[model samples]
Every structure is written in C-alpha cells, then in structure tokens.
Target chain A: MNREHDREIVRYRAPTRINHWIVAISFVLAALSGLALFHPALFPLASLFGGGPWTRILHPFIGVVMVVAFVLLAARMWRDNRIDARDRAWLRNVGDVIHNREENLPEVGRFNGGQKLLFWVLVTCVLVLLLSGLVIWRAYFSQWFPIGAIRLSAVAHALFGLILVCSIIVHIYAAIWVKGSLRAMTEGKVSYGWAWRHHRAWFREVVSARRRAD
Target chain B: MALQSLDIVRRSATTTPAPQARGAHSGQVAKLIDVTKCIGCKACQVACMEWNDLRDEVGHCSGHFDNPPDLGGQSWTIMKFAEHEHADGSLEWLIRKDGCMHCADPGCLKACPSPGAIVQYANGIVDFHEENCIGCGYCVTGCPFDVPRISKHDRKAYKCTLCSDRVAVGQEPACVKTCPTGAIVFGSKEDMHEHAAERIEDLKSRGYANAGLYDPAGVGGTHVMYVLHHADQPELYSGLPKNPVISPFVSLWKGAAKPLGLLAIAATAFAGFLHYIGIGPNRTDEHDEREAEREAQRLRAEEHP
Candidate 1:
C-alpha cells in the first residue's frame, strides 16, 4: 500500500468520461444512419431510426453532435496523446505488446503509439467527413454546389465514413483488449497497477504530483 | 401507375434483378423533337401542365421567350429558347424542349439510395415513385443531363416520366399530342430513328449540312431524343454536354465503393475478433502489481538520493 501503484488512481475526470460516452453514443447513431443510406442492402437499418426519411433527416445532425463531442474530448486529451521518439520506440515493439511482453517495450505515457495514431486518423477522418457531408447534405447545402461537386463529395463522404467506422472499431477493441482500461472511461479511474504496467511514465507523473501535494 | 405498367425492369437501390417473366413486348418507346420546326410556342409545355394537373404560377418574365422560367415541381417540361447567329450573320431561334431524357441507363435510379423510389420500366421509361422517395436529392447529382428537381412542398423528386402513365393507356404524351408544327413525334424508338433520318436528309437538302440526331449513346441512349438542325453545336441551344455520362465519382460512390467499403468495415471488426482469440485479454495480474511497486520504489529512491 505504500507504493503508489498498489492503489487506485484517477484516470479520467467525470466531465471527460461523460463527454467520451457522448461521442461514442453519437458516433454509433450517426454510423448506423449513415450506413443505412450508404447501400441498398443496409437500407433496412433505416427502420431503426424511424425509416429512410428519418435516417436521412437525422444522420447529418447526429454526425454534428458526434463531431462536436469528439472535439471537446480530443481537445482535453491531445497534449497527452502527442507522439514522441519514445512513442516510436513503443510502436516498434507493438508485436511484443500484443503478445503481453510489456517488459521489452519503452515506457508508454498517457497514450501508446497505436492510440495516438488512431486519434490522429480519427481527427482526419472526421474533418473530411464533415466537409464532404456539407457538400452532399441534400436538404440544405447540396443545392448550392454543382452536380459534379455534389457527386464527388458523396463519394468522399462514404470513403471517409468507412475509415472512421473502422478506426472506431479498433479504438473500442483496444479498450477491451487492455483490461482495466474500460473502467477509466466508465468509472473515471483505473487500478494503479494497470496504469503502471501500461503507462509507466504517466504513472510516475501522477505519483510526482501526489508527492508535491503531500 | 397503371396495372399494365407494372413491368419495372430496374429499381433504385436494389441489388437483385427485377421480375421479368414477361413485359417489353412493345419494344422501347421514344419521343422525337425536331428543333428546326419548333416555333417556341410552348404549347407542349402547357399541355404537360394540363395533363399532369400542375400549374406553376405565372412568374415574371426574365426578358426571354422562356417563361415559367425553368422546370420545377409543377413544370415537368419547358421550351428553352436560344438566339443564335450563323457565321454568315443569319439569326436563327433555337428552341429545345428540356426535360428528363428517360435514359436507358438512368443515373437517377443508379444513384438513388431509396429502394423503389426510382424505377425504369421494361419499355425504357424512367419513373419516380414519389411515395417511396426519401428526397435526398441524390438523383439530381446522379443525372448526366441535370434533370430531377426536388419539390419544396413534399421534398420528393419530380421530373418528366416520358409520360409513362399516358403511354400505358396507349396514348401519346400530352406534349406530343399538342405540338402544332408536327415537330414533336412519338413512336417506337426504331420508327422515331427512321423518321429522324428522313428529317435529317430534308434539312441537309435545305443547306443545314450539320443537321443530325441528338441521341447520345453515352448513357446507353435516351428514350427522349432531339433532331437538332445544328447537331454539331448541341451546346449552342443550352448547356447540353456534348458527351454526357454518369459522373465517374457517382459511379465510384454507388458502385465499387459500396461493397468494398462494407467489406473493409467487416474486416476491421473481424480482425478485432481474431485478435481476441489469439492473445486473450491483457489482464493486470498480481505479478504486474509487484512490478509496479518495484518501479515506484526505484522512482522514490532516485528522487531521495
């Protein structure tokens, strides 16, 4: 109990956890409605959102909510997610990390290299999706653009949406793969042992702060 | 639609083939417009409005012979009037009937995301089932000739159907029936082509050397075609693209992108499942706690020393 890593430690604040869940919930909704409009085979999914018309009506608005929520979440965590030379070294040992050979890897900080990469990829995908979404948003903005541009934007929107969906799947899988990680977002805390094993540098920073407080 | 017109060969946003045990016995129908003989009277336009039971308000004119200005929810068809000057300084009024072409490969149907919203009959008339239309306006982008306007009232797409309703009843479209100059003709597509050939010959004899047919094959040819006196200059009449095809982007969007994008998403999810099976969960065990305590001790000693 004398060791800081032997006890519980706060990983996320309540506001951040709430914001993350908002982004997650909104993203699932937007993706479902978007996929409904993406292909005819998935058209049946539109019924989940009240039908095709409602899916079309609510998809962009849902996307906006997710984007707005993610912006806040990303802003709150971006400094910790910044990749450095140490992150590159951790990336080189990704196979070992996957095999549970944490001893062979460099000390991970707040986020691993994979997490940082996914974060940046998500940022790019969201930016593209929002812009292209505006260009093809039929009820409103599409009328302002030319047919050629609208057609192109529709294609771009689908492409980036696929990337976003895939990235999120990986994001969720990563959270599940690392035990005790889900609690960080769900309960706003993590076992200090889990933090020290996965994010040793960050665990040390937290301990140094605790020392300063004392 | 009438029961007789139930032979939908292709439906929008549908992957499976349509039921085609019969139908298509009448061959494909077509409407031919001879631009040289069009007097810009707009009688066909009025007839379309009367037959369709739509009345676009008499909007203010923009100093052109074209009135009710452009096609809209109520106006399915319109006469586009263009003033032209020949190289020899001869003025000719080029009048064109502008509406849906009823493309053999309808782009609106191809791009539509709502099942049964847009359909193509076996006889080649592309029709919109407004009841099923979600009105995302994808058809407007899908069109090669830029037809298919959405109604502000109900947010459903509207365009000329080549008057499939009248054709099903064995009658000509109201526009074709009302043309005063014998300029607008309707028949089987083959007969219309033969008629256009004879008209082209007559125009060539009268010194319009460029007179030809405007049945562009880029969209697999359209059910509605034009016999333009200056066929070489189709753009002179309006912004008619010389060679219109479904935009490459639309093809990519609704075509390969669909199955491939879905596949990529599924593969990502499946990969996660496989990873779970391969590595199991990375749990923080008692050994991990001991390791963390050792590291904390090392950190404390480094700080104190």
Candidate 2:
C-alpha cells in the first residue's frame, strides 16, 4: 500500500466511479440481448439470460434502463465533452494518436479530442435508440400507433445500433492501444512513471503538491 | 367587384411570396413508399441507372424485371418481393421499395472518419460526398439498412441522395414519378407525417389493426416513414428487426474505458512536466538540495536583521 502512495494516484470522485460501473454493467446486459436478436446463429447467446423467451422479455427493459442511466451520465459529463480550440487542434493532428506519438501532440487537459467526440457520439446514439425503441415497441406503442410509423422506427433503431457498435469498437481499440489506461478504471490509479510519460502537465501539479507538503 | 379581386391577388401574393418559397425549396425532400400500392414496376430502377449514367448490364437477369438483388454502387434502390400467407389461407404478395432510410441520427455520419463525406443535409437526408471519402468501409459496417455500396472502380461509398438534385429543383424522385400505383408519396416531412397518419386511420378502419406509422423516435426519428399492411409483424415484410439496441458494450467503450485511458495519458504527461522543471518524482535529491539552500538564505536574512 505504501508502494502505491509512492506512485501517482489520480482518483475519480465517488459519483463518477459509480456512474462508470453502472454503464459497464448495463452495456454487458444490452450487448448479449442485442446479439441474440441480431441473428439466428447467435440465438444461443440468449441462454446467457435464460432462453429466447427470457431474452426477448429482458432486452427492452434493459435497453430502457441503459438509456436512463446513460442520460444521467451524459448530463454530468456534458460540460467536459464540449469541443474547444485545443480539441479541434487535437482532431486535426489525430494521426499522432494512431502512431503512438503522444510527445508530438499538444498537451491535453482532462479529456482529449477523441474522448470528447466519443462521449457526444454515445450520447446521441443512446437518445436515438431510446426514442426509436419506444416508437416500435409492439407490446407498448403498437396498440396506440399505426404500422407505418412502427416500420420507420424499426429502420431508424437498427441504423443507430449499427453506428453505435462501430464507434464503440474504435473506442475499445484506442483504450487498449494506450498503455496504463485500463488501470484508471480498474485500480483507480496510475503509476508515477505512467503519469509523467503521458500527462506532463498534470504530473507537475502532483509534484507541486509534494513540494507544498514538504 | 374590382376591389374584391385586388384583395384576393394580394392575399395570394403574401401567402406564396418568392423569398419564403425559395427558402423552403433549398433542401432535399424525402419520399415514403407505401408497399401495398406498388406493382413491382422497375421503371424507377432504370431511370436511376440512366440518370446516374450507371451501366445497365450489371445485374441483368433472364426473363425477370428484378434487375438487381440489392443496392450497389450502380443500383441506388430496388423493389423487393415479400410473399406471405393470409389468415384466409391465400397467398399475398407484398412488394416494398428498399432504399436508404436517411436516418435522423445516421450511423454513416457517426462512423465516417473522413470529413465532408457522410453528412446530414438540412432536411434530414443523409448525403454522401465522394471527394472526402476514404473508402474505409466504416459506413458500410455501420449502416443498419445496408444502403451504402462501395464502388469497385473508385472504392468510395455511394448511396441514395434522396435525389438531392431533383428535390432541389422541386421535383419528386424518379421512383415516385414512375410509380404506376400511388404507392410512393413525396413531400415535406411534416406533410408526409400528416398524410401517413390519415392513411393509417383509413387502413385501421378497414380492420388492419396492426397498421401504424414506422418512424418511432429511433435514430432521432427517420425522415422517411412507412405505412405497412401487416402492422403486427411488419419486420416480416420490412427486413427490420423487431427489437433494436445500440449494444451497451459500445457505451462502456465510448463512455468509460476510452476516456479513462485519455485521463491516464494526461496524468502521465503532467508528471513529465514536473520532471522537466526539476520538481518531478525522480528529483527527490534535487528537491532536498533546494530546501537546504532556502534554509541557508533564511539564516543569512535573519543575521542581517
């Protein structure tokens, strides 16, 4: 534990931490249900929840919960997700990210351009899924609406789902691409060297803290 | 009588002023196709190929009007046949015109890494610009309708622009113009919504209880809406999934993992800045030296005082 103190420790607030886990758990449930519905070959995946009947019953409910939880998450992070001049520059030189040339890129603050863009994209996708899902919901809205409206909603929902999945794949690959990144979410801290190598500006703040303490 | 005629002319002029009309004319108008009214005529397909100067012999078949099976670089849209058994045990053939949905929150737009390639027009039509496209196939993977087709020649993506050129000139799409049945409706989104509602009510009165309008708030609500005959199981005819979801794993990757990774990078960079300024974790000896020097300076100042 003392060794952990010797290392840099950047902690997320309790709310932020809890919100992340909520999203993580909900996402896993949603992905399994979605896979079962997307193709018959993946129908066996329904067994993860129980069987086809249970999967069908649980899918929409889980989706609703995900949308609600994500909306709350979006509300809290909206300010940080906004694009700024630095973010624009970062996007312009996004090649630096793929090449692992972080030293050449501009010093990023809290969230980088990639992170901000992902946040907004996810938020937009969730909103679309929620609305489209509700419109085409057979048990719920089909009784009140017309067939034409329901068909259109189904198309919109499917399109958004595909886009959201692709964007998320990129998001995952980027996380694994960068070293010491998974630790921030898992252990809630990064090493002193990891901090210095990646976030020089923030590393200075921590060093200043030690100086003030001394 | 002359005063009344002059008042009528003034009312007409005010109501249909050129500036307001021009403002309304400046965007692409989408068409919602009603499958029940279609007769499987391939006139629109031929017109699209001719207008786009696409080759005709690409997906030609023998003794069949269905030229192409699906949308491709050359084929923007096609009419698909859905055969089903009615409650009375008779066979019913439903022909649907399949094309781009032009979703409000288009997946192609989100997945497109290239700027100015896949964009949503002001009128909610998702338009493609080939010049900026990287041919990444991301849009192809992301589109739920499988609308975008990569050109074998140039390797860029192409899809229905909702006839953006024709719509700009206040004309309906070729498919709508050639429809033998009044199945395809082209107009403003609001007008179509009202028309779709009335059509659904008419169908409901005829005992099509499952009939409902399809744009249900998904992907921010699609510009195109559909009126289906089999409202209970429209997916059987529409090629649409009953329950669609944006996989939650995607949310975790975008919302949690990626941002946390970036934060870790920022933290490491901040540590490096400290090291460069000689106050980093690696400079404990230097920090002690600085402290001793500061104490000596304090003693000298005290002695002088």
Best by lDDT: 1
State how far residue A23 of model 1 sits from its true place (Å): 0.9
**Model 1 ranges with Cα > 4 A deviation:** A1-6, A210-214, B1-4, B297-305
Instruction: For residues A1-214, write the lDDT of model 2, one tens digit per residue.
Output: 6744755456445576677778768877886676555433355677898864466558778988888888887787787578888788888997676555666777665567888998988988888888878875544554365444544555566557656766665565445555567667665666555555555444445454531210
Q: Output the lDDT of residue B291, model 2.
A: 46
Q: B193-294 in candidate 2: lDDT tens per residue? A: 788888888888998787776674546667666788775676776475443333233233223433354354445555444433542122223343344335
Indicate the fraction of true inter-chain contacts that candidate 1 also forms. Answer: 0.77
- DockQ for each of the predicted structures, in order? 0.72, 0.02
Candidate 2, residue B287: Cα displacement in angstroms equals 20
Retained true contacts (fraction), each candidate: 0.77, 0.00
lDDT of 1 by residue, B92-200 (tens): 8888999999989888999999999999988889999998998799999899988889888888899997888899889999999999999999999999999999999
Q: How big is the positional error of residue B302 in model 1, measured in Å on the Cα after superposition?
A: 5.6
On a 0 to 100 scale, what is the lDDT of residue B83 in model 1?
88
